[model samples]
Target: MAGKRVAGGGGREEDGSKVGLPAMDLALAFPQATPASIFPHSVSDYYQFDDLLTTEERSIRKKVRSIMEKEIAPIMAEYWEKAEFPFNAIPKLASLGVAGGTIKGYGCPGLSITASAITMAEIARVDASCSTFILVHSSLAMVTIALCGSEAQKQNCLPSLSQLCTVGCWALTEPNYGSDASSLRTTATKVPGGWHIDGQKRWIGNSTFADVLVVLARNADTKQLNGFIVRKGAPGLKATKIENKIGLRMVQNGDIVFNKVFVPEEDRLPGVNSFQDISKVLAISRIMVAWQPIGISMGVFDMCHRYLKERKQFGVPLAAFQLNQEKLVRMLGNIQSMLLVGWRLCKLYESGKMTPGHASLGKAWTSRTAREVVSLGRELLGGNGILADFLVAKAFCDLEPIYSYEGTYDINSLVTGREITGVASFKPAALARARL
Candidate 1:
């Protein structure tokens, strides 16, 4: 009985237990608005920020928003429930000509970082999993090849990737090396004509269906980390889908195992000689992660906004109550603050001065804010918030991984802290003691 209260409806306790009342009679009680038109406006209607973009950027934002609302928002819940990627949406998404955004040449859209961040935010406003897929493909995979690959490699891969014919995955996190990726154990040994890879990568997104995978491994002979291009179905390479996840269930993360997987020498990223090169890629990817929490906050705010206006308590609408208004305002303020910082990071990235420390600060701040916003949203929804049917429950569950991935909060904070003070804080206490 405690969990049976219908959303947006008042209930009374009976026989020492809670009992929900019948649905409110809207036809006679409130003649102005109908349930059919209650949600006619998009969630973006609640926020007002027209001066943040130029005409072109605003147009791009509107186009992406329309596509996401019409295509992605409708079926997201079903796909998420089944834990299946919406492969059919690929063509439609590609038709927007935004797959390889932010990069010049190879038929890419060559948009600005602001436009790219807006696209990510709009897509994520509908579903974070879909946004993440795009982020990994464009920011991690294509950008890596563009920045660090040979000219021939770029010419070969960038075209198809721009067209979305080649979905890509980046494999760096191993079964044991998540936050400690610089110390990965995956190894690549040179052979007669190529190289053989042997190791395991866990939590690799899109690997189960990607056309190409960018894998990072240590060279056995030189003992230096390197990046490689590994095509799907390579010999001795296996990717098994990780299932029954509590969050981002539709994204298709995999556990990849490589046993002497053969890759031609040409496939190795020539410019990637050490973990330092890989860090360049991660620095950009972390900025994209900063936008993830923005999306999560948007989702939570939309749900909570709808419920507060409809739900009634003590003969008054919930929105009219001071405490409820305070909670909703606080959530909005937090979102705006997070967005401001994320936008500044994008600007810094565009100016060509963005550092890992800057990206780390944004990622850590926004993710922690998003967690709090979603938790407050769940509290506002009361019992129904825990049910998946309401969507807030899913937002609550999904925020956990976003906070941990792309570098956990503690790691990011230490990164920024060390940069500001010129102190190395990443060493373990025992190691620091030994050094002293």
Candidate 2:
């Protein structure tokens, strides 16, 4: 009996129509050592750096990795392409209960410094924008209050922020002053019950929609820098989103305008009195920034390794070539070295023995190495590397902001050099007179 033919794809014939040819073996016949799988599973951790982590630390990494893979990985590329923030994912992220990182109490997670550092690395392993968003919220904004806010302020703010009920941003850099944060232009005039903040902040993360903003303004009376908590919908406070950024596009960086914004005395952070006080925050954050590149570099390496294994040219797999293998090896070496440095930096932080200069050195060295690693990854990918869909292009561009921020490469190096040498290089070059 003749079978009726379907009008679509299938090996069938009806009436006098010819049957479709037998299915051909179209799969590639390349020699392989192991079955191919989509990344993460096949990623090479050449040095077994996970062995150094504690059980809690590894658990945190695994949990965060799962979150990033399930939630962030699906949508990050789209958000990056649109240059928009993912407002919807905040709840799921907050559910992870890592907002406090190393901070104790006030509904905070109270995790160890190393564990917190591991979380940041895990986040960066997927997307730098998401990790930087956390860096701004947890490392900078929440930690500012944890370290310097009054008890009443902490009781009021910390719980909501810890739960992600309220997103916060730390405002310190201004349009005219980035590296020289001490020379800020923002002014806080003393008023009847509080302060009238009149100035602006630039490059503020989470500023556009954050419920709370921690602003740094110089006191008009004492001429000292101070931190003030300003709520959203303040009469004269406006946060305009910065546009056309090439890196970290998913983060909502803003130019915040303060037009006589009044903050109650209770909102003022009493503990932040000087640049020295602010340095406390920077010291820890710089260490975290040092870890960011390590994760980002590992991500780049993972992508390259997978591409090399699957992509073929001249009827040979890319991974089979010697030059391509060297590139991956170099990237892995950079990742391992960066991982060790960041781990040691965390130990120093845990011991309370980490100096700002030591942190500056780590941040400087690791970010520099990551640049090389990402550049090599882009090369290994050839033409496909430029597309955000492949991951390396976005990561390569994202590394720029990370490199320049925290501190410029030369600036961090000079900071380390200043600590090693007794002389300050930033001071005016009076060596011309010393020659006499």
In terms of TM-score, the best-performing candidate is 2
lDDT of each residue in 63-181, candidate 1, tens digit only = 98777767776677778889999999888677666777778998889988877777777777667888888888888998899888999989999999989998999999998999888
Candidate 2: tens digits of C-alpha lDDT, residues 144-243: 9999999998999999999999999999999999887789989999999999999988999999999989999999989998999999999999999999
Instruction: Tell me how far the alpha carbon of residue 102 in candidate 1 is from the true structure, in angstroms, after superposition.
Output: 1.3
Model 1 residue runs over 4 Å out of place are 1-48, 313-315
Candidate 2, position 250, lDDT: 97
TM-score of 2: 0.89
Clashing pairs in 2: none
Please list the Cα RMSD from the true structure of every candidate, rounded to 1 decimal place.
Answer: 6.7, 9.0
Worst 10 residues of 2 by lDDT: 30-39
Q: After superposition, how far is residue 213 of candidate 1 from its true place, in Å?
A: 0.4
